[model samples]
Target: MRYIIVTGTSRGLGEAIATQLLEKGTKLISISRKPNEQLIEKAKYLTIPFDFYSFDLQEIHQIESFMEKIFSNIDVTNVSSIHLINNAGMLAPMKPLERSESEQLIANVHVNLVAPMLLSSAFMKHTKGWNIDKRIINISSGAGQKPYFGWGAYCTTKAGINMLTKCIALEETDKEYPVKVISFAPGVVDTNMQAEIRQTPKEDFIQVERFLTLKENDHLLSPDYVAKAVIELLETNHFDQGGIIRIDEQ
Candidate 1:
């Protein structure tokens, strides 16, 4: 049996991926701020309510213990493969750096960058002795690779994740039971985050018009489409063959 853990399943891309994975009969553990009612009704899904906003992710030992408790009941011997999708993220305080508030900046960094790092470390440490194939997918963004005028915090966190993926992949390459890792960029999907971007005033987000154009021109890829593409990539040998990848490229 295959087991998968996905974060941010409250909505958007996370919801899409969780839905598809459930349909494929994968035993799923979903982590989100609140429980997803639809996912709770599904047979193989285990929803864990985790509020990343309030949690102190820097407390590594505590976080590791929490993750260990969550996975303690799973019979690792029966699992053929295990996957972790670090898909939780946020795009807030969308404004120039000079106008960005300190609290917002700290929150964004904690959620987008720090949380994933701790979770990834916990996953690797706990599963090290398991005999199943292990894989980690960090959901990244185009903003991570390119500098967007108003997305300083978002861009920096994503860039950090991409680099983290590279470093983790390098460290695991020659291990006896290597864990494959990939930082995946799911380009321009029609999610609530896009809606938030389009709603931002020009004064705050200088490139707001560009996002509006993408929406108007029907250029935004649907969440379902991107989720399917991601799953396809995950099921193939191509997954984790490299440090960073784009869904559009797949």
Candidate 2:
């Protein structure tokens, strides 16, 4: 059976992804700040509560231990493949860099960039020597490739993850038991994040109208739509040769 671990499954795109995976008979371990009642009802899902905002994920040893605990219950021999989907992220404190608070910036970095790095490392270390095919999908964003006003922290962290994906992909390619890694950009989806963007003051988020327009025009992709695309991509050999990929481009 395919075993998949997904972060940020409490809501939004992560929730949709987890739901679809469970429906397909994939065993899932969902990590989030709060338990998702819908996912918890699934027999194959194992919910692990982890508050990224409260925890110091920069502590690599703790991340390793956390992953170890999660993997301890599984018999690696029974699994055909293992997948890690780092889907948790935040876009907050949207303001110019000069106005952004240091603490908020650091927190954003930890959740968006540092946690994924640690989790990927722990996954690789723990799954070493296993013959199963391993894959890692990092939910990235278009903001990473292009700068947006008042999105300094968000853009920077996204950019960092993209580079992190590239670096890990390069390293894993040479491994005897390789892990395919892809930084997937899911185009603007109609989610809580978009709602937050739309509500932001024009002074803080100059492009708020753009998001509002998308919502008004019903142009935003549904979370489930993006989730389905992501799952299909994961099941295919298309992303085996990995790099930065955007769902919209597919």
lDDT of each: 0.82, 0.83
* Per-model TM against the reference: 0.91, 0.92
Identify the runs in model 2 with alpha carbons over 4 angstroms from their true place. Answer: 42-61
Candidate 1's C-alpha lDDT? 0.82
RMSD of each: 3.3, 3.2
Residues 14-58, model 1: lDDT tens digits? 989988887444677777777777766654244432222223443
Candidate 1 TM-score versus the reference: 0.91
| True-structure Cα RMSD, model 1 | 3.3
Best by lDDT: 2
Q: Write the per-residue lDDT of candidate 2 for residues 97-204, one digit (tens) a residue.
A: 888898888878888998999899989898888887789999999999999999998999999999998888888776899888888899999899999999899999
